[model samples]
Target: AKVYYHDFVVQATKVKRLCTTHNTITVNGQFPGPTLEVNDGDTLVVNVVNKARYNVTIHWHGVRQVRSGWADGPEFVTQCPIRPGGSYTYRFTIQGQVGTLWWHAHSSWLRATVYGALVIRPKEGTSYPFPKPKRETPILLGEWWDANPIDVVREATRTGGAPNVSDAYTINGQPGDLYNCSSKDTVIVPIDSGETHLLRVINAALNQELFFTVANHRFTVVGADASYLKPFTTSVIMLGPGQTTDVLISGDQPPARYYMAAEPYQSAQGAPFDNTTTTAILEYKSAPCPAKGISSKPVMPTLPAFNDTATVTAFIQSFRSPNKVDVPTDIDENLFITVGLGLFNCPKNFGSSRCQGPNGTRFTASMNNVSFVLPSNVSILQAYKQGVPGVFTTDFPANPPVQFDYTGNVSRSLWQPVPGTKVYKLKYGSRVQIVLQGTNIQTAENHPIHIHGYDFYILATGFGNFNPQKDTAKFNLVDPPMRNTVGVSVNGWAVIRFVADNPGAWLMHCHLDVHITWGLAVVFLVENGVGELQSLQPPPADLPPC
Candidate 1:
């Protein structure tokens, strides 16, 4: 194992797209930023210098910091933001995780441009479980906005409504030739006639789940969220924000150009979203440019309809562990948490003038009816570590206080969710199972819930409310797929289990930027065990203070 050093200069650089130019905050002046390749047991020491105007902090999206919570970044969850002109170094070792993960700004609206790929290859002298590919490429799917993203979220925050949808979807930070003024910057990938390649596809789009496909090529699913899968072939796959999928693609097509395209897989009815496609080109090696400047039409794959819930469910359920998975079958803690949007009534005498939600109410979301509000002065981790009071409470409900038909109509009185900085306490090394139940309060939507610091086994997923008596029988305990994130289907539920082995505060939330802003989140405070190895390491001397 070795230490890797990187200087992440978060500075503003002018980026032009869609016939408009804006000063976008990026790492090291690269739009998609630099890819960090490291071995499984390597340590990463990334010094993030905040040269941008906004307070910033970078989160290693799927890296389990283990007992080193001081390096787990999530604006005000694990640590305070590095103020403008300030700097902080994230130092942590990637213990057992190996595969494609990513790093991004955990602060408000800033991840719109501040992000990069964190690739974890196998440990030194170790080989991949599958055959080595001829080459590997990182395909980062994203969203693009013509306006300042900060302003877009600010307006939504003030009005209590949905934020403005992005202007276009992006593949490797380019909108491809589908949009005007973008053809010149389309990303191109070259491949030999019959070689195989590994595509590390990541969904970094702020608010939408994307469907990705390649013209005249099929993908064999090999891994996801850094965990190896059973390797099944498919034509299309969907990825929610913060999720990564590893697929092997063969260059078995004719010697021609093909378009790799991505669009949204929005399941929420009445939801506003970008309906455009982003693409990149896959050209045969040494393929010449079209003669006489007349370009041939690139072949485009048939993506699923924007609202195809069945397709999304089928793709998600197709994942399976290649071998026996270690799941905590005898759960120590069982919790049922409901997640969805809710509406808060306008204040008395306000007459709905300031509210912009359903029936003139403010929009919000929650887990177990508690809307997670972050502490401003210090992070939950810092407060818990130093015994600081009034920062957060550890009484986050283990189950919904009231029971009802989660996927059906509920009483209007249950529409408002209480907001607080609440966390669930867990004993280190305890096995736990959480039934993430999605509701139809405001509208049923697929919420990609990402849990930091641990990869959990997705035991089972099905539509409508979960019935332990029925669903328990359908659990795939032997070969459940492991992941750091799982998309809770619309009007449905998913069961995930993990050991509370990492002591520290870990934030679990919806990866959709808009849903997170509406308070769809929770924190888990796992108490330290007896020895230093099981407890959090001492805070670094240079740890940023609030």
Candidate 2:
């Protein structure tokens, strides 16, 4: 295995988009930052220098990190944020993972512009499970706000309401020709006749799910979240934030330019979202060029509607492992966690501006009724390792404190969630299954739940409340698809199982940044097992202090 070293300078750079220039926080002054390519079993040592004003930490999303919990960089979960003018090194190995993964800032709202693709090819002397594509491209779908993202979130935090929706959806940091003043900067993807290409599609958007399509080409999905899947062809695909989909596209259409487009998939009934489309041109090498003075437009694909839940459901249900897999049948720790939004009554001392949510209430979210709050004094991992007190409590509930009809009209009393820095303790080698139930507390919507440090098999998913008596029989234990993230369907539930083999303080939360900001998260503190190999590594000397 090879060890790769890199320097990431997180600096503020002035960038123009949507006819306005703003100081955006970026890595190495690159908008989408840098793409790091490595093979499976390779080690990465990234030194992140926080030159920007905001505290920052980079998370290697979907990279298992193995025994390197100290490098799993979720602020206040695994490690403290690298403060301004501070530097921290993340050194970890990519163990047994291949295909598309990503890296992004794990701090407050910084990931809006601070993110990148982490591509893992097969290990040296090994070949891909499928035929090699003639070319590979990373399509990063993101969001852009006219105002400063940090300021936007700060205002939301102050007002105790939902933040302003983004101004535009982006494709590789460009709003594309569909928006004003973007035609000249629209990304163009090149292709040759009859050749196959790999598209590593990543959804790095902060608060939106996206539907992606090509004008005249079909995609054979081969992998997701760095794990191989049974190849299936589709005309459209949906990706929630922090999810990656690997699809192979063949240049079988007429020699012309077609638009590769993405639009929002807003499942929340009345929630406002960026209903704009961002596009890139897929041009064939043999296509004719337009006259110098003439303007030609590429053919655009018909994307799904913003509220197309049926399409999203179908796309997610199609994923399967290519081979019969090992899904744990005997679960040791079974947990039923409710994930959804809630409303907190405005305090009497607070003014109207601070209670701007529906009916003068503040928006909140939770898992099993506990709204996760991060400790400011120290990180959870550091507190646990050093025997520090008052950082967090290991009392996260395994189920909702009070059981009600999850998808039904919830009682007003249950709308308020308690806030705390709580974690669930687990043995290092226990087999676990979690039934992530989506509730209709405020409004039902798909929550892309992501777990750090391990990939779990998505056993099954269905709408309405989860009944283990009936749903357990529907589990696809033989060939369940493995992923680091799964989208809990709107007003529904999903069952995922995995072995708790890696020792770490792993944060599991909604991929939507806004949801996490409102406290839709939990931490799993897996105790170290016997011996050094099964235990977490010691913290680095340069680890950032709170």
Task: Point to the candidate with the largest TM-score.
Answer: 2
> Which RMSD values do the candidates have, in order?
2.0, 1.8
Q: What overall lDDT, based on C-alpha atoms, would model 1 receive against the true structure?
A: 0.89
Cα lDDT tens digits, model 2, 1-546, are 999999999999999999999999999999999999999999999999999989999999999989999999999999989999999989999999999999999999999999999999999999988889999999999999999999999999988888998988899999988789888888988889999999999999999888899998999999999999999999999998999999999999988888898887765422222337888888888888731211566886887777778888889989999999989889899999999999888879989989998899889999998999988868999999999988888899998999999888888887689999999999989999999999987664589999999999999999999998999999998999999999997689999999999998999999999999999999999999999999999999999978
For candidate 2, what is the total of clashing residue pairs?
0
Alpha-carbon shift of residue 476 in model 2 (angstroms): 0.4
Candidate 1 segments whose C-alpha is farther than 4 A from its true place: 267-275, 286-294, 349-353
Q: Which candidate should be chosen as best, given lDDT against the real structure?
A: 2
User: All candidates' TM-scores?
Assistant: 0.97, 0.98
Q: Candidate 1 versus the native: TM-score?
A: 0.97
Q: By summed lDDT, which 10 consecutive residues of candidate 2 come out lowest? A: 266-275
